[model samples]
Target chain A: MSGSIAVAGLGPGDAALMTPEVATALADATDVIGYIPYVARVAPRPGLTLHASDNRVELDRARHALQLAMAGRHVVVVSSGDPGVFAMAAAVFEAVEHGPPAWRDLDIRVLPGITAMLAAAARAGAPLGHDFCAINLSDNLKPQAVIDRRVRLAAEADFAIAFYNPRSRSRPDGFGRALEILRDVCADERPVLFARAVSTPEETLHVVRLPDARPEMADMRTMVIVGSSATRTIARSGAPFLYTPRSAA
Target chain B: MSGSIAVAGLGPGDAALMTPEVATALADATDVIGYIPYVARVAPRPGLTLHASDNRVELDRARHALQLAMAGRHVVVVSSGDPGVFAMAAAVFEAVEHGPPAWRDLDIRVLPGITAMLAAAARAGAPLGHDFCAINLSDNLKPQAVIDRRVRLAAEADFAIAFYNPRSRSRPDGFGRALEILRDVCADERPVLFARAVSTPEETLHVVRLPDARPEMADMRTMVIVGSSATRTIARSGAPFLYTPRSAA
Candidate 1:
C-alpha cells in the first residue's frame, strides 16, 4: 500500500491509552518498525510486517524503515511514549531530511502520544508543576562536557529535572555524574524523585535527598525527577509526590 | 451516577488527538463544567449539561461540578490541556482532600491530559528534547521571591524553561522580572520561544533571544519556552523551532 508515513505515539505502554487514530494507522500500515520493546507492545495483527531492532541501532533501523516507505510500503515508526519526546519522530525526520534521495517525498505526520514525563508526572502527583527540565543521562552520542554544562545550567535555574536513560550497564556512572552536578549547583537537601518503570507494573516512586540517591537504585529504564528547592514532598496516605508550586507560599 | 469522577486528558487541543476513553467519558457525562474557553471546544451532544465559568472561578466551578456528581449526576470536569498539569484536576483533588466534609467519599480519578508544555514543545519542534522546567510566572498565589529562586535555579541548570501564566495586564512586569532573573543565570543568547494560543487556529510561535524578547509579546494566555544553551534555532525555509537534543553532539 502506498500512503503517507505516520509516526504514532503508543501512550505510556498501555494499549488502552493509544489514540483511536493511531490504532487505526497501525492496523492500516503495511509495516511496523520500532525499538524491540516498543514494537512488542502491539498485539499481533494480520498482514503486518514487524521490523524490530536492538536499541543501539536506531539510525540504521530508521533508515531501513524510511527506505521501506520509499519502496511504497505504508510504514508506521513506533515509539513507546510520544514519538516527538525523545522518540522516533525526530529520528525519522532527520533521516528523511538528511538521508538518501529516494526517501525525501514521503508524507510524514507525527501523531501525539503520552510522553513519559507527563505520565510520570501524573504518577508522581505533579513534580512538573513548576518549571522543570528533563535530561537523558545516556552519554552514548553526547559528550560528558555538554551533559555537565546542561545539568549545571538546569540546577542553577532551579528547574526540576527528569533524567531519562539515567544508568545502563555500559555507562553505569552517568546518573551519578548528573546527581553530582545538580547537587553542586543546587542544594544537597533538594528533593530528588526516582520513578522506576513509571506507569508499568514495576512502577516505583520514592522521594529522597539528592545525596541519598545512589547508582544502584537506577538503571537505563528509570526516569528520575530532581525537584527545585521550592519542591516539597507532601505525604498523602503515606505516599509522597514531589510538588513545585507556582509559588512556595 | 455517583460512582466516581475521572478527569482524563484530552490530548493537546485537537479532537483527533483525544484518547477514545476520554472522549467516551465526556460523551457519557451528564454534566460537563470548565472555563468558558475550554467548554466552548466540546461539540454539542444530547443530555450534556454544560457549565461554563470565568477563568478566575475555576476552583469554585470544579467544586460545584464535583458536588453535582456527588449528588448522582454524571459529571466531567474539563481543562484545556492535561487536567493535572496546572489545570482543574489538582483543584478537584484539593477540593476533595481539603474542602468541606461532604467531599470525602466521592471516588476521584485524575485521568491524565495532554499538558500545554508537551503540546507547545511539539509545536516548537522538540524544545524539550533535554532537561527543561516549566514555571508559571503568575504571582497570584505564589510570591515573587519563590518565582525568582526557581527561575534562577532553572536557568543555572540550563533547562528549557516553559513559562505558564506568563503575564496579565495587572502583572505586566512578571515576565520582565523572570527574563531578568533568567538572563542572569542563563546565557543572554539563549532562545526564548513564545507559543501563543497553542493547538488553536490563532496559534502563533515566536522564537527570539532572551535579551531580545519584549514583555508585550507575552500575556496570560501565552506559554513561554526558553531553550537551554544547547537549544538552537535552525533557520530552515524561513521557519525556526527550538530544539534540545538528547545529546549535545
Candidate 2:
C-alpha cells in the first residue's frame, strides 16, 4: 500500500458546495484527520479510520496525518473552507518544510473549495465584485502590527476586504482593533457585512455602516466584509443587495 | 409563470468542481444565457433554451437575461468562474441600478463557485496562504491608470496578488505593462505562477522568478499569481511546492 495524503476543503458548512473531487477523495480514503468539527463532517466507513483532534494544534495534526500517510494509509486531511486559505494547506506544507525529506514526495495535493468569503459575497450581493483583498484577522500566527498595517493598506488601495477568523474566544479584542483601523482609514458610510455561520442552518447576515459596525457582531463562525467606497446598496421589499460596480467612475 | 434570474458560475473548467446549488439552478433553468464558450458547456434539452452571445457584450447579455426572466422564464446567466467576482452578477446589478424601477424587485441571486485563483492556488500549494488581493488586469472596464495604481499599492501591502483576465487578444500589451510595474515595485526574485486553463485537461502551470516571467506565458485563459515577500518554495525530489508561511518569521 503506497502512502499518500490529500488536504481537502469541505466548504462553509454546506455539503452541497462540496466538490465531486473532494467527495471522491473522502470515499477513497483509508483514514481522515482534521479539527474535531471538520472530522465530524465525515462519515464512518468499514475500512476507514478517523483521527479527530482539537483546534489550535494544526502543526501536530498535520504531522500526524503525514505519519499516517507514510505508514501506507491513504490519509485525507479536511478543513471547513478551502484548505489553501488560512487553513490546513499551509500548515501541511509548513510541516513538510521541516519534516523528513521523504515526506516531500508523497502524493500531497491541495483541493480547492468554495471558501467562506465567496459564499458570504454571493449571499450579500457581490460586495467583492470589484478589486478585493482577504485578510485573516486572527493574530495567532502573526503579529498585531502586521494585521493593522495590512488593514490600512487595503483600505488605501480601495479594495473590498474579507476577513477570516474575525473574532474567536481566545481573541475578543482583535476585531475591535480592526474596526478602529478601518474607521480611521475608510469612509464613514461604507457598508460592512457580518456574515455568521454562513451557508448553514444558523446562517445570519447583518449589514451596517462603518461607524455603526461593532466588534461583538462577529463570532468565531463569522466572516466580515468591509466594502470599498464604490460599494452600494439597493433597498427593496426584502434584504437589500450590495455590489461594487464593474467600472470605476 | 413567475419569473426569476440566477447568475451562476460553472467553476473553472471541471464539472466536478461545480456546486450542487449551481447544478440545481441549471437543471431548473428554462433558459441559459452566456458567452459562446460558457453557453456551449450546457447540454441541449427540449425545454431549456440556450442563448450564446459574442464577447465584450456583458451589458447586452445581462439585459437579454433580465428580459427573458421578465417574460416568465427561469433564466440562468452563466460565467466561467464565480459570477459575483468580476463576472455577470455585477453587470446584472448595474443594469438594475440604471434600468426600470420594477427591475429592483426581480428575484436575482448570485450563486458561488470555485473561482480560478483559489483553484490555481490549490494546485500550486497555497501561494495565497496569507493576506492576498485579486485584481482584474483587463483595461476595458477601468482605465490603465487605476490598474497600475492598484498593482503598485498591492505590492506595497506585500500581498500575494491574483490577476484575472491577465491577457486577451486585443489587449496583449496590458499584461506586459503589469509585469513592468510589478518588477519595479516587488522583489526581483519573487515567485510568479502562471496557471493556464486550470482544472481542465488543457491546464498548464509554470512558476518562475519575477524577472523571468513574461507576458507571452499568459493568455486569456491564464490566472497569474505573484507571491508576497514571505512566499517560499519547498524543493523536493519532484516538483517544488510554493507557499507563503502562516506566520511571519
> Considering every candidate listed, which one attains the maximal lDDT?
2
What local lDDT does model 1 show for residue B46?
86
lDDT of 2 at A201: 97
Question: Judged by TM-score, which candidate is best?
Answer: 2
lDDT of 1 by residue, A136-233 (tens): 77657777786788787667656677777788655778888887777677755877777777767888877788878787777666778787777666
lDDT of each: 0.72, 0.89
State the fnat of model 2. 0.79
lDDT of 1 by residue, B94-161 (tens): 55555665565565555566677777777666667665666766657766776778777667656677
Clashes of each: 35, 0
Model 1 chain A poorest ten-residue lDDT run: A240-249
**Candidate 2 clashing pairs?**
none
> What are the per-residue Cα lDDT tens digits for candidate 2 across A1-249?
779898999999889888888999999999999999999999898999999999889899999999999899999999998999989999999999999998898999998988999999999887988999999877475777878888888888889999998886666788899899989987559899999988899999999989999988988999999999999888778788899987742
- lDDT (C-alpha) at residue B31 in model 2: 97
Quote the lDDT for B89 in model 2: 88
